[model samples]
Target: MHSYFGFLCLVSYFLKSLPQVLCQRTHANVLTNETDAFINRVLADWNSPGGIAVAVVRKDDQGAWNVETKGYGAATANGDKVTENTLFGIGSNSKLFTILATGLLINNATLSPRLEWTSKMASILPTWGLWDTTAAKEATIIDVMSHRTGLPGHDFSYKWSDDVPRLIEKMKYQRPSAEFRDVFQYSNNMYSVLSYLPTVLLPSKIPFTRYVKQTIFDRLNMTSTTYSFSVARSTGLLADGMARQGINFSDNPFGGIPRALPFWATAGNEDGNLVSGGAGIISNAVDLAIWLQTLLSNGLRPGTNESVIPAEVTEKVSAGVSVQAGAAQFPELSPLVYGGGAQRGTYRGHEILERGGSIPGFNTQVARLPFDNLGVAVLTNDNDYGSFIIQVIKGRLLDEALGLDKIDWHSRFKALALTTPPRATPRPTNASLPWTDFITLTGTYDNPGYGKFELCLIAPKHPGASRSCAALASNAPTILPGAVEADIPTFLAEWDNPGFSHIRLTHFNGNVFNLSTLSSFPANDSSKPYWTHGGDSSFSSGAYAEAAAEGRHVGIGFTGIWGAGAGVPGPIGSTVRERAEVWFHKIPYDMDFHLE
Candidate 1:
């Protein structure tokens, strides 16, 4: 009787301990189906076009690694499904690779001591002329990487141009947004310039793309990744790009009746021939997992004795150099700091390193919790919902890894999206101002940072369209699809060189004017510019011109959002509330003036 009783007690004890042991193992190696379901549910709920792919890698209790991959929706509207190998633009995530490549060159002792991060740009690229020599000379490589150069994002400078060298040459004209090392302004142009450094310095004369591939991608066996869109397409791995048909929520299929957008319309459109250090890499979830694993493993290849990136270099590159304000929408993640190419922050008591990238039709996010030995990479093709979807997935994954109760990220994000205010309607135009009101506005405007532009009054084609001195003009013929028609009263705003030249403007109110292209304005708002075409297109709410310097000058502010498509929210300050403005001084058409 005693022996039987002891056996029963032992069984009870073992039964109680079994769950604890299993739970520990599960925390390390196991990913619950509920987590997968949640990811799928979020993507489905968003009705993400071209689908989404996610890769997760975590370490088991015994130090062994496990990888989980999930793909939801189709890669194309024709029903081709997303897979682990489907290629998607990684966007600015490419910046991290560029920074890593720089670190590698430094590690290899390829750069001279004088060319270190603290070295002046003028010293490094001496022949590269700069308008503000003093400020340019004071700017350092570290300043560029950490975005403390006081140079605002002159994103429009290269938004549609493939000529990187010309872009670099134009940098001389751009003014700093703030004092040296005083503020953080993300600048893709800086990174694009930085990408050329390795080619200039390397004895072998290899391009930046080749250098990255050899040192990083090749070493890590990330074969599916490349900086070239053509290369990705050649491999038949690139996913089709997609966009929403109309801006209104009523146009959303999931919201009410299913309204199909012109999916796959932009499937094979080429972004450009040039490589961008800031936002050009194309990759897949499978390869990105390897990337995260290598990073988390302290620059060593997983399950191998080979060292890829030096641990010291990784630490140096990721060390916080500049502080960033916490995201208001994501209050849980606070104290964000910008490092070399990554962001360091704390989420729910766990330290994390994260980076996000967005291009025309793709959005990507890679996040790591080093202490937990967990990492996640998400790639999606839908620009509108991509950012929100990625965040929800990351949050859910973190909850699972940390054994915390799951948060309803999907519902919260959905609510936020639905609650976003609709675009404002333009007020009715009942009054027309006399041509004398804008008499002083037509002149050559020069900003040392942005160069020269001219605003000219166009002669009216129709008798009723204008008076003798009226500044009325007509829109240009359709250069892009869905552009404004030529009959609208317009003003020709031309840039000195190519790119963003030939903007047609129509008067809206007192000093405000609307931009029009070749096509008729949508019935919703003819006063606002809409970018229906894929890729980088400029849009504006309106341009407001005000007299300054007691009529000596006119300050024109181009207020609107700029990005890939119409009706999509871009980076903060991209809306009409903030604008990129330039001042025009009345000068002789034939007279030449040097910008101070």
Candidate 2:
């Protein structure tokens, strides 16, 4: 979903020599009736299917690029048509700005990537308080940009009125899923909190907005882009500011009360705050082009025409540090990629880096083909519709402009979609035992460090707080760590995420129950019970011990201790499953932890 926000490929060309043509085409104009035709075709498609807005930019003569904008639909259901300068919620696409701004500080030697923000900032802003000593203090600037921070996407409870002081206070509870940088975990919480570094370092009373504006936006001439949600809303720059897409946005925690805007601004955790790496930022496609063009030129700021960030820093930003091959509770963007919210791939045979953003009525995609000095920035007010528009634009403009092949498969699929009947795929079942036999295995389990946990046999309507647990029971087994309990079926059946080579399920009486790897159990009728290797262990037991000793597999075991460590619980001792529930209750770590 999100992690591959930039990796998701809408279409690709079959042209083999596109790179050669791309090098030659530089400094040439991509504008013509042909370019317009391609744009129109895509715009027409967007209009019929209903899209918000779209814009594309390609290198023109003298290293300049032409930007084309089209407004097809409204931002909200009852909103107005999009305009060329229409502002859309950029979502995580704003991370680029944050990263670039941070890079500026590093370039000027004002900030150290290795310095501990908690220590230095604590001295400057004592009210910020010390973060959890566990793994929180150890996180560095590099960790946040690289998505190595252990904090989850939305681990801290945020409120609308919370200011910087609240964000610092929230950090005291921000614990890591593992040691700092141990694994690539995409964390918006980390990104938001990391901004504090600059705020505390600058002059005593300088606000973050002014600092960013003076350093990044103003330097780059991004006049329309803004960080203040309230300003954007008041200025009419942001469309449907407090709405959501795909599903209705909720304010109530208990389901009935209307909730205020979650107001991510309060999280203060860098990774999840309104301006965190996950979301926040309001800008138009025109302004985004100026931003993307700077990145394509390797940190060259607009207007002033100065190098805002060093070339080395630019290289570091482009070169991905974290590899999220298969992370649960992470985004499942495509069959092969996963991450926070964006996906990356190639277009017209040229290497392309891109990210997509969507929140209720907003959808956007930002792509750059640095090799060809070509980039596309699309901002829309609709969510999924932009995905299709992206495909059309890529196929029509990029492919034809580069003399490549268009993606006809998407068109073919759309045409054939009306005739294709939905398929009924049975759930995976473990023949060794019926689901009823495993009912006793469900209950609260307690561990020392990690805290309390549970696995209850819930009715379909009674899905609880463990987001992943409900997804496991539902037919949609897309095992993203914090996905709604209803969507796990998508992942359970498909080997889409990176880690899974293939999927196999053993069912009792033809009813799918137990899931396993396809390669491990080649034959379905084998009589032996196909127990999960180390990582799949329900509790810390002999299997877990074996895995730990070998260090070959990741097991689903508890982190903290509960009862006596010497022996297994007898009549008075509780099983590991019960202990797991207790740990769930005690521990408060983010479920959506992964690297992008």
Candidate 3:
């Protein structure tokens, strides 16, 4: 069976490699009865509590296409459903524009990929140092585009204020999280560098926003897009702008009202400015379609005197960046790539140009099926479950645009359900006990990045091991799937065992001091004072019980620290690029647990 599957895959790849003839003939429509069923099923699985908005676009002929927009609740409740041209905040999908800006500069002979934009490289912005000295100095314009700056994913300590000088000053004291050319970390700060590139090249200094508007937006005629939140506010889009903030919630099949927070208006910078390489743009679907058309035409504008990106530069940008294989591992985040901030390779046998964005309120997706000259751009005011919708919708439409194997999206959803582990209730307090000594097991503990924890460790089976489990300090209930008991000392050490699916703890030494030491396996509902203090108190008691009772999903609540976004780490601010430092919270001292 493996050999047969491998042979089939090879055949698919060979067919995929062929130009238009075979590729066009084999296009499969994903909008069939089966496809519709699949779409509905996946949406239901991922939809959760909040509403969803979806849009689909496909190329029917060389110059022909159609667009369909659908909304599940928010729009329907207000008697206003989204249309083909409904504006969306395309979050970090705006980074591609930063790359495009670079391409434009190169085309105009104002920038060179080979030139090192460092102090020793004869560039003007020598003070704007690359994160690494040796290898960073050697990096060119292309490396920055690939997100290889040695900085950490974000700087949690810096403020996301609208002041550029403060950001630049703060960055001066910053350091690199990783060694240069060592690992691919998706550093939005690199764009902070790119955002300032125009200033370095210009005889007259220009803010990042002006550079984008004049060069990229003006040339492409993306009239609707702008980098300034003030402009968005003036245009009567404050509500929409606020809605685009990327607030996150539990991963339950029934998602709840997200922790909506007000976002400060920020000027677009090159890194995360109102116009930098990361997110910070708002535009409608129509203008973006033009942008897509330009990309599909390989840099050529639809009807114009210029190409949006030079062919060589476009290839340079598209060529895969060096990165570690397998998905990025961030707490609570589904695995995704850590290179260049987007998945750039082929998906489902098509050479796909893809990008997605997640901000406080906005979630967006843009993809181009180059072979079929098909492109799609989806933007939504709410991001709660937008990414899933984009993937499902795109998978369906691409099947139609290019003849490929019809995927049963519903079956995939079914497969998702089967794969999710079953939740178990904790063992009853009265079930069994070897020795119950709970006095000397509470105190404060600390780890650098994860922060401090207050623990009340208990020897549930006391007189068995040590009288006091030094390392296992928390007295908090230790909840696990199903129900099992072992020595507290041994369990605390191996709580993070490979076999365990879910385990939380209260560390007296500061890291997770109040998570899972009080309860035992799958307690559906308990009224113990589990958490007293420390960390961002984000989860509600009802929220946890509600999620666990559902069994389909389990929400392991982590305190809110800097860099809280899933996949995206640290805080985003208008600062120079710096080292990637993982942040941790401090634990309180009242709890009675001791360090080993």
Candidate 4:
């Protein structure tokens, strides 16, 4: 069976390499009944009600391209069905634009240093420094763009309100989880810093927004795709984002629970109000069709023989620069490698460059098969951890295109995705743990890298996370999912952080708390959370159980001088990204500090 499948893959590659014969099936044939059924069945099986826009572009005979675009499910509550042009935020897929925009500068370099992949960041920004002194001085444009920089994503540390320059200044303070180029650590902060490079590297000193607009957007004629939601909304074609009920944390299906989520907006403006360098772009299949073809042609403008994305730029962005996974995740694929903004690996013997991204309510995936001259993009207006459903869908699409044997991609991934691990045994709490234990530590604690937050004594009606969200925090019990009314002198970590209403901290032991420990409730409601907090996206709208289909949790511990001073070794941030636990010593006022 394995040899037969391999023979089919080889034949598919050979046939694709041959010049397209007009007698061959049209591109429309790519979306056969089999493909459609596969997509629908997986979506139904996973109980995903929100819609998705899928576009497939393939090189035909004579080097021309053929396309098939379609939409499935409702994009809005008014029952407006999703179509080829409905705009949905592509999330971190915007990183591709950042890399292509960098390619533009590289192609048109007139600077003294002549910025190339190897140009050291230190020369570009004197402020660019990191705890890894060697990496701080030696890291290059490619290092940051490829996420080979020592820093992990210290996502929560970013001030959504700060301008690019200030954000660049804050980069130095973010601790690094590994030495330079030791391992691949995905960092939005690293990508976020690249957004500012246009302003610094070129004589025009253009912000990323304006520079990419002049260079890439106009070149591709993507008028509908913009960093601004206002522009997308003006078309009256923006998709209303959705999430599964109780999915913010529960893995089980809630009857395909679909709830409308707000488009990412702030102070009555687009999500671009936050940051565009990392994750921020609203586009549809129409514009993305052009993008996929461009990638398929290695940056050419489809059949015109014109280069919209300089060929050199295209090559560098898609070429793998660092190892993401040291071992193959499956027998069919090669070890994963992150190119510039996306990932590259083989799938069932076909080479593929791909990436998956999501914000609070929207999830997206894009792929390029340079070897076969095929490309695909899927924009899903529903929340998912890694956009896995689309991942499964795309795999089957490839198999259908190649005429290979069907594999149960959905069931295999579903089992892996939905399998709930046994809950950890709870650490015994101090039997006499008193309210005084909470009150004593109820002050601002600070980290040089992560900054500061006030851990409050009350349930946020007093000493709120911020006065701005106080009313919301006070009413949080009614709004937040899995509402935890902690019985053992629980406290709330209140901060007026954008994208977050409040976080509930429950007592675990003497001085530690489980950030994510929760009590189950009937979370399958249509109404979205009044607020959100997440992995790397501080996108200030919609709901993200960001813990995802499973009740994912965060943990925090306060023990004998437990941070920098206490000699806790390693970086602080999500355990997924950090080398050690995040810690912050209590405020200076808490001298000799066991204030009970």
Candidate 5:
């Protein structure tokens, strides 16, 4: 769902007008009650049904950290107030912890054979192999962590039955959008795979969750940051999540009316969460301030000689290994570059490093001005387009602190959001056949790496558009993807998977289908907390959400393959063959591999 092509187009019109407002700037100020008021205003202006907890921390003249943590708006729908300790899921900001843990392992004196950024994945991870065999052999820890692995996030491919091991074994099946090391392509699967390294390397061989809790969390005194929400909720401080329906870009500052989005069940006393290294974390502003303070203090606990992480660890994590996006229209922000887990570049000509994450309902922004010893953590329980609200708050504060010209973030965001729709994608050369031709196509489809899924037809709202695979058998269909279909569906293919809900597929032509679900499925129930896409524990969705929502572009596609070269992403330089999107193959009613 993440490709920012649409976002680029939305903001294109505003480029010519940037000079008009270049002179305007926000008055720099200390963190005070007035700053709290402005935050509440932004949340209300954005129509957020939930609140945010923000922590701004910086080192002072005495070289000790100064922290200001405050809460704004209602923590829950009924008006529970947010405070410094209100727990919220920090989403992919958890990735930074994973990266830091890797750094600690590298710095460990007792680890045999020693690991470094250049330590080859093939040597450490026996199961590590991609379509590009040579790339797999040569790819290092940095390549995978920095997202230079050439693979896009085929997020729905892995099932959690085997957790990280199954996720690792499935890598050869994922297709790459760019050549190896050629571009920045984000994939959570890689980070999850990194979780296995400690298991293989450590003498004690602890899992990632245990290692992180011991190595970093305990050292920093971040007592409340944990994977177990059961513990968090018991304190009655964990914030409930809320979200808007679809991406309805509008001139109205209000977004799609928000509904409650429930907290994840797996986060509470569950034995396994497959993507823990990638996204599993929940913390609040006050605790995260300690994290930021440690980062700003160069991996040491502020006001102490002790180190939570080695000083060189911060340097290693900050070195940019991949250029993420250069689409900046203004001079204030430079093209983004990513290293380890966070993104690093210049903001207002000063070096800045930041990253953001979101699942279904919550959004997180963790940023720092390393050179200036300043950091900010904003945990929000609402999701708007781009989680732009978090940025609006962060941008405003940073502009004031850095003494840069203040650009009207909200107006530009609103205007670009409400832009007239772009032209529809040109239809493919192949014409779509009648609805009758598509129903039997329903059944199990498989790739060795992605696992098997049964594609059954779900009933459509419009009787005229409905086709039934249920008639093929008396077996009742499982629960629908969402509450029910609203519009008449036509020749739709439906299936349930780990990552997406409220989704159906339209046959583009033949066996080719676009990824219709995670991109733009409408919100089913806005009155209560619910979300349609990026089902429970979907991490790092913010990277390509805007472009995918506006353009309805599907980087995730399914095309049936036949004949010899089926379901295989062949070797790197192999003849540049014109293979169909052969990621998934049609199988029989039973679990047989051969077609009927």
Candidate 6:
């Protein structure tokens, strides 16, 4: 009877410890096979023209990590293959590195404790002269990093310019989208300021790029990572950026399939020929794996007990600093929080930290599961469809690691993508409406929130062709295109950002028209918000009239979408519910409009 009871106890103990024993036997080979198969499946599902590179690092029971990289598609138009060493633009993933640099500065005691993370911008940059004295006085380093400054993205204002100082100066004109420290609004302009702040505060007068390299990159041994466009171009390992062909068409929500853009050989050129602290860091799967390992280990270099970033600093930066607004796409990940350029959320009851980046030609995502000591970084040249692939792969990997049921992320994403409706076809304009109507619409328009811009009527280069309008000039100079019109009677609307300068208006009725941009995608359904290729501007109404007496001849109301990424669904329903409406009023051509 005693022996039988002991045998029963032993059986129960073995069953209780079965999962742990199986997990211990999950070798590097098993992980590698699973990850490779998962990535291959994702590549096949996405069918992107350009290459994608992914690196997954998992910590073993002994505290060391097993790293693996899987590369798919061509790295360059010239047919160079992607490898672990192939460098691709990491986009906003640069933000995490920037935050680490700031943390390192604080850890080193180079910055005063009070000013390290919470000092007011006005106190630190008193001489720079911000237009909004109130924001300048109250916005802190922590506020900016955590995206709680109540500022809107204002992405259009400095999309093409490399002048950081001028961009900072222009922030004065941008109004807050929310109350101070009350809501979350992602702002790259704010991050640009954060990256440059250390340079201003540090006594050595070091440039942001140099300071980051000397402090963080050098310490982590990220030898191939670079902040300079010229250096990235010089390296043969740099991957060529690719965008889908026919991206301007509204019918093609998937960006019309990726094609290599050899002109975008270097990633840093998008920031106006300079290294952008916000979205400018070029690295590869191998180097990024090292970065992930460092992050997972709480800023400690693996194998060598050397601490690159202080553990306390890492803990503070990773902790929630601001509550993210609304529910995320995955309900399990609700109540998101932002801290030091990374977002923290719960995934199936496990802690997950992530950040993603989208530039003109590249898309990237980096995620870490600190509790599991696992990390993944995905870089792709195809901007439009890359996010979908990354999210799918990340989700699958996490599910496998956590011993959760495998979800069909590919099928789910495909269903969502298929549900997205193509842009609405514009109705034919009333040819009978006199040309005088268009003539009256030609003038300069001004918005206090934006700036002065001219709309001029341009005669078609060919006879018997439609007359189009040209955006001649703007208070913001880099966006000027010198009065060139489209082949049709297209009117180009100028947003604060230059990339959003291509909206076309087709007349639908008297003094009313249907508005669309080269990048506009139709709503997935009436329940979902319309997707724009640029992910910024959305036209609410395009109308004009001959109101010569009031100086308000033409008016356009547009709602700007703030934080939607490539392939990500924006807030659903009416634009009014999700974004702020910006109004532009046309003034006489001779009138000198001024912004308040």
lDDT of each: 0.64, 0.46, 0.47, 0.66, 0.66, 0.63
lDDT of 1 by residue, 295-365 (tens): 89889987784898988778876888876554534656677778788889888888999899887667889
List model 3 lDDT by residue over 1-596, tens digit each: 33664566567677765344322222234345664565455545654323334444455543544544444433221334444444456777878887767665666654444333222321435554543566445666656666555555443323343333444434434445456655566655566566666676766677767887887688888776777666654654333312211223334433443322233335442323522446667666667777777777677766673876777666656666655334522222233333343555565655666787776456678877777667766555544455555555666666655555656544453344444343333334343321212333333333332223333234344333333444342343332221223432222322221112223342222112223311122212365312211111233221110001012211112322222223433333332111113322223323333222
Following a full C-alpha superposition, what root-mean-square deviation does model 6 have from the true structure?
8.2
Q: For model 2, what is the error of residue 136's alpha carbon versus the real structure, in angstroms, after optimal superposition? A: 3.6
How much does each candidate deviate from the true structure in C-alpha RMSD? 8.0, 15.4, 13.4, 7.5, 11.3, 8.2
* Two-way lDDT contest, 2 vs 4, winner: 4
lDDT of 2 at 42: 53
Which candidate achieves the best TM-score against the true structure? Answer: 4
Task: Per model, state how many residue pairs clash.
Answer: 10, 94, 82, 7, 2, 3
Model 3 stretches with alpha carbons more than 4 Å out: 1-79, 110-124, 162-175, 233-252, 255-275, 324-342, 410-596
TM-score of each: 0.77, 0.56, 0.60, 0.82, 0.79, 0.77
Q: What is the lDDT of candidate 1?
A: 0.64
Candidate 5 wrong stretches, greater than 4 Å: 1-29, 245-257, 265-272, 327-329, 420-436, 459-498, 507-514, 518-582, 589-596
For model 1, which pairs clash?
Answer: 173-449, 174-449, 175-449, 473-490, 483-518, 483-519, 484-517, 484-518, 484-519, 485-519
Residue 176, candidate 4: C-alpha displacement in angstroms: 1.4
Report model 3's TM-score to 2 decimal places: 0.60
Worst 10 residues of 2 by lDDT: 541-550
Cand. 2 TM to true fold: 0.56
Give the per-residue lDDT digits (tens) of candidate 6, residues 1-596: 33664565576577774344333423343246666776776766666667778888888775667888767777886778888888887888988888777777666654664456666777777544334456667887788788777666756455343456666766776656566776777888777876776667788877777787787788888988987667777888888766654443345555463455432323334222223667778888888988999889888886685898888888878988877645677655667888887889877788889889876667888999898888888788866677677777777777776667877888877677566444444444443343235555555666553566555443332222223332222211223222223434534454434244444444444434445433322332354323334321222332222122224234544443344222323233332222333445666534332321
Candidate 3's clash total is 82
Order of all candidates by TM-score, from best down to worst? 4, 5, 6, 1, 3, 2
Better of 3 and 6 by TM-score: 6
Using lDDT as the measure, name the better of candidate 3 and candidate 4: 4
